[model samples]
Target: MASGLCENCSQLRELTAHLRKVCREFERKIRNVFREFSECNCVRITPERSFLRTTQELPSLRLLNDDETQLLSQESLQALNKLAVSENTGLQMSAAMHYLHLSHLLKSPLPDAFMEPVMALLLSTDLDVQKTISLALVNLLVKNNVCKELVIEMGMLVPILELFQSGDSAAQCHSCACVAMLASSESNKDAIVVDGIIPLLALAKSYDPRVQQNATWALLHLTQSDGSTRILCQAGAIPVLVLLLQSSDSEVQFCSCTALCNIAAIREHHPKLLSIGGHYLLKSLLTLMLSSVQKNSAQACRCLQTLSKNVLIQEQLMELDCVLPLKALLKTSAAVWTEPAVTLLSALSAHPPNNDFLVSEGLLDEVALLLHHHRSSSAIITHSCVIITNLCSSRMGQQAVMESLCLSGLLGALLSPGLSDETLLHVTSCLNHLTTWSEWPGHPLNLSAAITAEQVSGLVKMSGQIQNSLLSCNCAAIISKLEMTEEIIGLLRPHYITMSEYLLVFLKKKDVKFQHLGIVTIFNLKKDGDFSSLLADSELEVELRKVHAQTEETRRLLQMIQPLSPSSVNP
Candidate 1:
């Protein structure tokens, strides 16, 4: 038994040695092929034949048969395992490239063993090899948190940032992408920032569009962290990103818009961005916001949302004629587009001056329609309510909102099920502003839409049903306003001053009421003979003398008393 065990050990060692030899020979042949390809200027190698390319284009992963996929995965991992540990530089580069290419094809995360050698290869001095490795790392780190953790743990940020700082544009692009992917993992964000990735990416954004796009993406990711946004702004990333907003590449435009969005998210950066040609950026984004492309338009709207937070920027945007385009977007049937448009309009409306533009552009009706159409979507409802609430800030906007039939929409929103607390706040606040118009002494809106007696009674009933305090208060106020209207007073005249037994008993005991009744009768003597006759036998002289003695009380009472004029008594 001992002899047999020894023989088995010997065979195992022999098998290991044999496998190593095979890998070495295969590595040699692949290196020769790469050398030959590089040497020939006219040799055009399509990706279909082999992964090698003069342009270093990204590898396309084809679907493999189930059984074949498993076989290839196992064999390729084994080859990579050998090639990764090889001392030869060519072998290491090829292994990294293979890892990059195969990662897209694999169904699972790359094994832990593959990280050490690939990370080590990032230290190579050869520019071509460094570019290849950077590309490999970029592909590996994308949305792959495990790989990102590994990369972070290996302390690869400095090397990666250095590559981006000094390498060619292509290398810098890949390095920026890798760094951005690393920042995608929340745990690694601070580490990447600490390693000075922000300034490097800010500078790299000045390169060609591709590099600028990736750098912008990295800056965008980094800015998501606390304080990193200000760091990016301080590093002067906003102007470069703003400049890229006009790039013909949709990706460049998308990334640049999103980055500036992040910068503008910080209220402190608002002025800085505006001072650095943000108006031009706003113009480009406003134009792109209505683009047919969903991503381009969506990103543009998001950026506008950030820019609109600045009251000054909002004014600037209006000056650029952004209102019309935004109005057009507000009219889109797509909720995806309408949501941000509504959000922006809501922001702009906070400044009273823009309220005029919003009204002049006829935007309230579109917002009102959005509220009714997307009643089921909480986000849409919230945004629409906020817009209406802001639009109510100015008299002109309020008039426009009332004319747009948004008052009913707001009422419906107040009763909507599943309405968020924010939506409820805005809805109640909007109603408060709209109903308060009656409180405005001489405003046309005060008497423009008189509430009927039935509506006033209904609102009183609604006040009882409403559990929200703001809502109940506004409803009660509406009822009070309606009761004060001439039409409502006429309809409710019999009820307002009914001569019930309870009132008669109460008035007899209260001397102040008796005096008030006497003064009121005297004032109505010319307006109605019957009212004067009714009080003639009540000792009007005595009550009038009492009212005259309490001068202050009499003056206040006289102000409260109104004669039974024909307009009120007959209506």
Candidate 2:
């Protein structure tokens, strides 16, 4: 019985030993599979298995998860540091660095310790890697926002600026985008300019179109601030941009045009752009506004809009025969061109010199044609009518506008129930301008009287009908101009409460003319004691005092307009 019991104990011990060996083997197999998956996933693994083979069939092994990701990053970075010292390994190191970055993107925020090593990659000899790393850093920095202080502290401006001069288009584009993103902060703008972004723009002129486009875009962003505009102009970016306007690539031309617009946003930069043959280029740009491509036309129009803001540039554009092309574009068959075309014409007609040009070019006839005949979008019709309004606001242009029978169509537009708020405002304002035209050298006062009465009736109807603030302003201005005090007083006699509220609202507006109109309308209505009570109750007296003060201030400024300097004058 003792021998049998001993035999059972021995068998039990052997079974226990066999089970332990099988457990160890199973653990080893699981680890091997994990390592294989990590390597395949391009993640980091433990040092022991990083360079170890998982099987005879597959020579390379990987990590299980984020552990392997970190391992690969450390190894690649170390390799990059070593490879930076040698010429041949530069390419390999670049590839390896990119691989690590790809891995980093797949993971969460990297440990703060990795910032230094990753930034050093920007200084790599391989332009490809330098650009890749620069772009990657920009993405990381913009996304995190926490990297700004750290990146600025690292003194990265010089190396990154040097990349702007790279011959590789992709490299240059990426570098430009990165720098632009970094310089978006106002405080950073100074450092970026000081780092030679302006000079680099000069060197980058010969790059491919994509690079040029990005460089110009970056230059635009960089020059948005007051200080940077001066720096960029001093660095010769204006001339470069003007030349780039002649580029065959529409995209480059568009970017160049946009850059010019930003630069021209600064009033000081305007004359400088004009002095550098910007007018000649502007003529070329106007020619391109006829392009069938919407983007090109839109960009050209935008540039023209910016240029027109400068009195000098506008005069130059007028001297270069810009009005003819602008008029032609306005009258084009394509309705898409109408809005921008009308805007350009409005801006051009706002100035005295260009107004004279428009009159001479028979632009009023063209505008009348659009108002009388063209069936277009309400927005386009509104813009066309507004252009006429702007043109007729000038003394000489108003004669041309009225003689062209613009009043008939304008009155129709104002009285038409289907007219949009925008068109109503435009037609009313045009009437306001023409109502002041008692007589002209070529036309008699009778013609003006007939037109003025028709316009006043239409505007009064509109004032009672439309609800838009701008339309109301236009109606009030026309009423003020026509001396229709009795008519307005009679209209408000029965509904003094509603009239008082509307007049009070109009008086509070910042527009000097509209405010004056409100005051005049109120003073004329005061004949009725009931109207006076309403006006006094609505505080119209205090508002009238404010409007009178503003009018005096405005008149003082207007009286101070000296003859422009020769350089200031557009001709």
Candidate 3:
């Protein structure tokens, strides 16, 4: 046995081996097991063969079979690379085969000098050279990440992607594998999508199942790009991927589902998916969403969550009786699908038919149970609040929510410090809908009847906070959304001076919702007599006219203010 140099750094370092051979019961040949070694130390254990440029004959690299011997010095690799690209067909074939053989024996990547020759051989018109090199490339790419980066850094990606259109099954199969390996890196995804996506889509219909499988896997990684969905769909990805979602091969179907998961996760892409696969994609995702396999079901649930945000999607889901599965998933205690399922229901519950069906199915109790179990997850809490908010839009939904035990946690999240700003925004918005809401006399059962005047004062003060504008704006918007009942006005009376400033400052801003909220809230608060005279002040009059010019609601309010003259002239 010969001592070996470290294949990676090509350094002459010391590494101890505990080698033993044992014969199987019926075999004369013995098997040797190699245990993993820890670290390499520079103890000058052995001398390496130096690079030689002599005119002597090259060693017989063809007949070598010693798997444990390190035959690749930097010099031998350079010599083989030169011969691999030679114009003579016989020399090129032998050198390419020797390089492929060396890839199996050496545990390290081929040096930087091997990249150009290997790339040239890959793009060669010869079938044997292309086939052999593709295998060797896949092996190197799997064992060494240095090779993956080298493939991209050397500008070999555009040429390598060209292999997908080669019209050769062997070339296409190995090419798909190589592209998927390259795309597994986060940094490599965008570059691959830039040049490789069109040719990549065609392989999904390859006569070879292996080619179809690897191509879909490549798309799975490529679609991980944040902005890749539009380019992929416009390149005819939806039709091909949707067909693969129904593939006889489970792996192909899984990969296709995952790629679609990435695509559908972008809400804007749903319409394109709908336009192409429409009912087919919708039903396929629904079936996978309820799959017995955990991974398939989880991914499909995420896709359906974003797709459900579309109105047509929601209508289709309702006709499929999606509420029953959603109800079952919500009550499964804790599931990978629970949070997204809640979000999907939140979208569905916004529609009238879905809301009515959800009420009839008694899903409110399941939602309340989910809140009790997963209350610690801010996402789940936030989505649950959205569902409650959507459900409140209907009379039956409001009745169920008001009668259930979910209100305490829903309202308690308002003051809970652990809740995120997003959760707080949805929580407060949900509270507004659940409370004494009215546009023109809404149902008046106020769960927010529990909000005290002190809490109102704190919320009113929060509206003036400059930091967390989302929170401040929401705080003011909710107060404005509330129907200013006598008790509500009485709560505003104590904070009238501060409350007036909030309303006036809001009127000077551009958001029409805030402007409307300020006017509606002020209109009810002016019954306090002090606020009425404040409304008659000249400064208040100018702010009023500015508001009047911005929206029609302000015009109606101006007419009713006795001291302020109504004017429609543009301010």
> lDDT of each model, Cα atoms only?
0.64, 0.65, 0.70
| Residue-level error in angstroms, candidate 3, position 229 | 5.8
> Which of the predicted structures, 1 or 3, would earn the higher TM-score when compared with the native?
1
> Compared with the true structure, what per-residue lDDT tens digits does model 2 show for residues 206-310?
557767766776676777788887888888888887777777777777767777778777777766776754456677678777666666676777678777877
Highest-TM-score candidate: 1
The order by descending TM-score is 1, 3, 2
Residue pairs clashing in model 1 are none
lDDT of 2: 0.65
TM-score of 2: 0.59
Per-residue lDDT tens digits for candidate 3, residues 1-571, read 6545457534323222211222232232311110111112231232211111110134535335444243455555666666566664545566667667766766765667767777777656677777777777887787782467778887767656777777888878888988999998877777887888888888887768899999999988877886666778878898899888777777787899888888887877877788864488888877776666656666677777877767878788888877766665676555566876887877777776677678778877777777767766788778788777777768777777766756666655565557676777777666665655432244344544656666676678778874666677777766665446677767877787787777777788787766777777777666667678767865656798877776677677887987733554433
Model 1 C-alpha lDDT per residue in residues 1-571, reported as the tens digit of each score: 4445577798998899999999999978976885687556554453312333421222221222233254245445455555455555565576666655555545566677656656666776666666877786776566362468778888777778887667478777778788778877778877776666555555445557777767777777877876766666776777777777777778877777877777777777777777855467778788888777777787788888877766777777888887777777767777787777777777787787777777888888887787777776677777677777777778777778657768667656655667665565566566666766645444444422544455444444444443454444455444434433345445434432232222232234344543343344245332434434554545444445554667777688898987679988899
Backbone clash pairs for candidate 2 read: 38-63, 39-62, 43-68, 44-68, 44-69, 45-68
lDDT of 2 at 353: 53
Residue 237 C-alpha lDDT in model 1: 72
In TM-score terms, candidate 1 sits at 0.62
